[model samples]
Target: MDPPEQLALREVFTAACRAQRAEVLATAVRRFASAILTNLAARPVADLLADYFKPVALYAICELVGIPATQRAVVAESAETMAASMDGVLDPERRAAAIGSRTALSRVVDSCLRSSDGSGVLGHVARNHRRLDVPRSVLVHSFRLLLSPGYMSVATAAANAFVALRAHNLPLTCLSRDTGVDELLRYCGPVQALGRLCRSDFDFRGTPVRKGELVLALLGAANRDPERFPGADDIRLDRRPNPHLAFGWGTHSCLGTSTARLVLSAAFGRLADQFPAAELVSEPRYAVRAVVRAPEALPVRLTRGSEGAIR
Candidate 1:
């Protein structure tokens, strides 16, 4: 997973993610977000994490990966199990369950690729990328890599952003702009750290890191560094020149960054316009996970705005 091989694999994944088709992805996101929000609006009090954000994130990624509708429930359940297992990495039972879930997800991806008629991202990659020399196993793993974070991270970030904004009494309107969204991403992004294997011995601010060792860049801390971001402790929706590492930095950044942004914007924009009086029913209970910081449950009560529901 080094150099040309890694680069080749990334290229294939990038293509499979429809990275070049921003408009297509945006449309798909809006469609899914609208549907999820419609359901959310029906409930007087709903768990936003489970009812709104998670459903939107799950549907968007499933559509992108070309997973059949009938199979999405199983796929989403397995993916959630796999993500939650990270918190119990030391427990043998959880570890075994994670392995089983991963295997099951890979099999699903294999089936989708085999039966694909070259319609969606998975189909396109499976049908057209045979000359890349990437292993089938690697490709499947790449899809899992895309699926897991694409769902968990995006959903978590959206949920976290809601809580953050509400706590600050900031209107959801802030999310309408790219700068506001980026600031929320910097402040409430779910990824707490980025782990990288050192390629060569190097000095990190007087600390020596050996080659072949694991180095964790603390992204959460870096995003809040006062030197890099003025008034780093506060949420600044108007923060400019904000070069946040919420999505990591350099070549290894999250592949679904743009997709995440589109999903968030569509989701909050629809919410703000349709349900401007939305309020929290109760304080959100945070999930106690290893890497991702998100709510276990976000209870919210929605009231329709003058504009009415999205149709």
Candidate 2:
């Protein structure tokens, strides 16, 4: 985050806190979930969860950031392109894809400038763009920051929820019923870790750290912390009190925290109502990322429905 964009994000965050409430986020998630359920009718929920969640989650963020709805696909494509390049296997095809996606995103930003309405994130940047303090590159990177952090988070989260349903054999009836959603979230926290560079020397749980030292805030460990959660090693889907840090803590908490909750809430609700007997055909290929931890590939099988119906 550059100084100028940093200034902009502070403004956006300040405005978001004052203007939008929590339920607004929840409503957005429900709408996204309904769309997924409709398109994924009779299909394995996990297979398509990532695909739908991205566009939906991206749109919600764009809307919140003040990006117009018309350019959602364009923003999502840019995000998807950026995400693909993170894999340790870079190649010509991947580079080409990213270049193309970046081109599209730039075009979207250009379009926003042309639009007289100017109502989205691009709108914010264009409307509030500074000549000296904030350069064009700075604004672009700042918008990219909002997209970069949450893409993998939302995708992994959707898949994590799908996996839990498979492992537990939870039924579709639960989606409509008043069941424990937080418990599932706590038990299978979508993110396994977050990054932090120690600001100063400190000791935590007998481990010593120094200033500027990079640290992995083990999310899996925190979620399963025995001190906070009894029997932390086990997954308690109906946990009474789940004080996990799946969304991190302090200043760097996920910017899309509310948006993330919405994506997961909607995704799981529809998934539970759709596929009740989905199971993993093979163990998920867990990602090796230090920050984002989730399955790179989660191949699963459907024993019921045409693809996910009642079999």
TM of each candidate vs. truth: 0.91, 0.70
Q: Which stretches of candidate 2 lie over 4 Å from their true place?
A: 1-11, 17-32, 42-46, 66-74, 84-116, 120-139, 172-182, 203-208, 238-240, 274-290, 297-311
Question: Tens digit of lDDT per residue, candidate 2, span 1-311?
Answer: 53443655557544543455557766776677677656655554345545555556665676666666776767776776666555424355666677777777766666665666666455545655554365665556555666655665577666676666666665533323212445555667665654667878999899999998988667776777778988876655556656667666655555666666655566556555455455577767775554455677766554445334432
Tell me the tens digit of each residue's lDDT in model 1 across 1-311.
76766887777777767634667767877777777778677678988888888888887777777778887886788888877776554556766788888988998888887874844678878776777887789888888887888788888888989888878878887788888889999997888875789999999899999999988777889899999999998998889999999877767777887777887887788788667767788777777666678888888888775322211
Report lDDT per candidate: 0.80, 0.60
- Candidate 2 global lDDT: 0.60
Off by over 4 Å in 1: 88-92, 305-311
RMSD of each predicted structure: 3.1, 5.2
Q: Supply every candidate's count of residue pairs whose N, Cα or C atoms clash at under 3 angstroms.
A: 0, 6
lDDT of 2 at 287: 58
Q: After superposition, how far is residue 178 of candidate 2 from its true place, in Å?
A: 11
